[model samples]
Target: MTPEALSGETLRLADAVAADLEGVERLGVAYSGGVDSATLLALAVRALGPERVVALLGVSPSLAARERTIAHRVADLIGAEVVEIRTHEGEREEYRRNDVDRCFYCKDELFTRIDDEVARELGLDAVAYGENADDAQRPDRPGAEAATQHRVLRPLARIGMVKPQVRDVARVLSLPVADKPAAPCLASRIPHGQEVTPEKLAQIEQLEAALIDAGFSDCRVRHHGDIARLELPADELPRAVAPGIREQLQRAGKDAGFRHVALDLGGMQSGAFTLQILNARGSL
Candidate 1:
């Protein structure tokens, strides 16, 4: 919807986010070019001005190349300066273990880097990430704990803006990624308890890029040892299994080093394997 089409409630929520950043001299946003973060960045730029806001992107193998490119494009669209930081989450053994809290270690590394380097050099008074209200209440988001520990502000969650509200604000701001699907780190493709390695992440990225090339943009290639468990949205499942498309997907999986390719009938799910592990361990 256009900016003029935004409802009063949505506009009020957007104003609340800007109001939350009132006293900060300079702000650093943990941006990933997704709808939530993009909306936050756009609003922050509007409130604090583009010169006062910096988009900090943590570059690592976990981040897909395509995603990184999109992130830069989005930041440029918002007229905010982009800073790329190297995160060593992979060097942390706890992160490499790939537990349910893997995101915690990754986020911890990113925030730590920002605190040690970016904050001081860039004169940033505060940091924020795009955690919406829905994510604030979710059990799957251990990364929120890291954000809390780092004293990073969550304007969207603080303003009680959920995913739909965030998307609405994004559309109102004319952000390019307003309707983009959520794309988690490549490491999430591995089942919980499986060790996260650069190889696995690269393989998952390769197959996913191939899937996008084959016309399935929103999909997941869960790395299950020798098998690549494909997860596509329900509506795309039929197309995936079609004769020509099925063979294309199979070849893509094999080219990515999978011995067998399997399509999950349950469809694409966010944090699917992690939730299953959490359930089995009675942590849910």
Candidate 2:
């Protein structure tokens, strides 16, 4: 859609993004199929045409299969070609260390892979990510530091567009993930100090997908060794405790190889593990 097709602040926001991306012959967006990235992809397509834009999805054990499918679907919807780049952050000891800077290692590996393997072949003039104003200011995202080191463009954050603005732009563009809750990497569900492994990630994915299939719209199956800590939205907490739902969740958790299934009454939290660690260090 053209900038004239949009109106008011959304139009102004879109214009700002287009202006930021001007003069780039070809652009690649680091896409995760989340609303933020999806919005950036859509905006880039609008600005530079789908032919000049590519959505680069980093495939790894950390990324859920469902998310991968969604990334492709969203790219198709936005008229941008999708390129899957297999990342090996798992091979990095720093990433497996699972400390607060784990995201930095993961992102660094992705950017390095892109720089070494993708940019030249794809003839990409520039690369951008979906960091919004809120994420730009957040202390928990060490991945942002990696983006800075790689000089990845952050149009949304640069234009001061926050989460709500990104969602609004998604709505204007009719993106499917407009209201989708934040779905961090499967590794994020594992607490700090815990080694991130494919097995743990698989377990988390299985249980989280099961929870979604069980009718909970927003949920997290946090991996705590053998314990599967289930977190659902506060409003859905009562339904989750209902006899049938509770039993189903218990069965699902067990099927995912968890020794115990526990509900977090505080509800689903975004970046709970990272925030907890950062807070403990008095960093935030």
Candidate 3:
């Protein structure tokens, strides 16, 4: 669909969201600063006003500092009260195990904490998050289960909004994150079954930052033991493999603590490692 078509849908969805928040005295939103959550926060602020809207950001070791900065900026733009709550997902054994469903435990801790602490402390009527309709079809997203368990209200999903629609709303509201790529957690760079460590997360973050500084915007630094697999956009693959640039990337990866660095010629695919495992198991 065209951007205009998406924008029209978002306008309708925003109206629906405003209608949904009409009776809520105080609304608490689980904000991540992505287009989805940003759009939701903007609409919520319009409906309930800044005084009644609170944006709750769950701070954790896995969360990138850049993402937190964006979250704060978005809250500031909307004049919403932003609450930074520390989440202990890394301390949880289930999350540390790094299973495919690791996000479940992390999100469970996050939502539970927000529901009990942030909501109660702030006297919020409802706890809401930005889970759009498109996410319903993604089987790999375990966080959705946690949202359901914690009874977190999903206004975007309830109103039938999707990723494109969220971006559309964000554009209409002039949110900076309207076109930002999805940035999951730093721990996602590690393969499932691998224990997540502070050092490994740091390494991935440093490598990714380096790649971005080198002009590779959409990229992933997948950690596998001492090997760093760089995934760049298909169009950027040639540039990444160029002799001089490849040498520079190799040196940067080494500096980031990787013994060997290799670019994935298969291109940049979201959940590439997961897809590989699934394909190996005949599940794809």
Candidate 4:
């Protein structure tokens, strides 16, 4: 669609989200600084005013510093009260187990904390998140299950908004993250079954930041034992393999403590390792 047409659709979606929030006396957003959550926060602020809308960011070892900064900036732009809650997902054995449902335990800890501290203490009417219609159809998002268990509201999903719709609305609202790439938790880089550690998370974050500094967006530095498997977009493979770029990346990985560095020709994908596991189990 043309930019203008997309903008129009996005405005409509934003209006719908705002309408839903209008009746809420006080609403807390599960803000992640992602385009989806940022867009929803913008709408909530517009609907309930800044005083009634609270943007809650769950801080954990898995959270990237950049992500937290962006989320705070977005909340500032909307004049919303941003609450940074330090979460101990790593402390939870179930979460640190790194199973397929690891996200479930992480989010469960998050929402429960929000419910106890933010909602009850602050007297918020509801705690909402940015899950959209597209995510509703995705089977592997265990976090969504936790959100449901905690009775967290999903305004975008409730309004029938999908990924494209959220992006469109974000553009209409002029959110800085309107076109930002998805950046899941740092622990996501570790293959399932590997215990998530603070040091490992820090290493992944630094390596990914270096990759971005090297001009590779939408990438992942997947942790595999002593090896770092870089996943660049398929279209960027040629650039990534240019004369000295591979060596540079290898050095960066080695500095991060990887003994060997390899590029995955299959390229960047969300939950690539999880998909591999699911496929191996004939679940996909």
* Candidate with maximal lDDT: 2
lDDT of each: 0.92, 0.93, 0.85, 0.85
Check candidate 4 and list the clashing pairs: none
Clashing pairs for model 3 are none
Query: What TM-score does each of the candidates earn?
Result: 0.96, 0.98, 0.92, 0.93
Cα lDDT tens digits, model 4, 46-157, are 7777778888899988998978988888878767888889899999898887988889998999998987777877779888999999988876788999999988889899
Which sequence of candidate numbers ranks them by TM-score, best first? 2, 1, 4, 3
Model 3 per-residue lDDT tens digits across residues 116-224: 6777789988888888889876767889999888888888888888888788778878888999988888888999989988899889988998898888877888999
C-alpha RMSD between model 4 and the true structure: 3.0
Error of 3 at 254 (Å): 1.2
Runs of candidate 1 with Cα error greater than 4 angstroms are: 1-7
Per-residue lDDT tens digits for candidate 1, residues 177-219, read: 9999999999999998899999999999999999999998699
Best by TM-score: 2
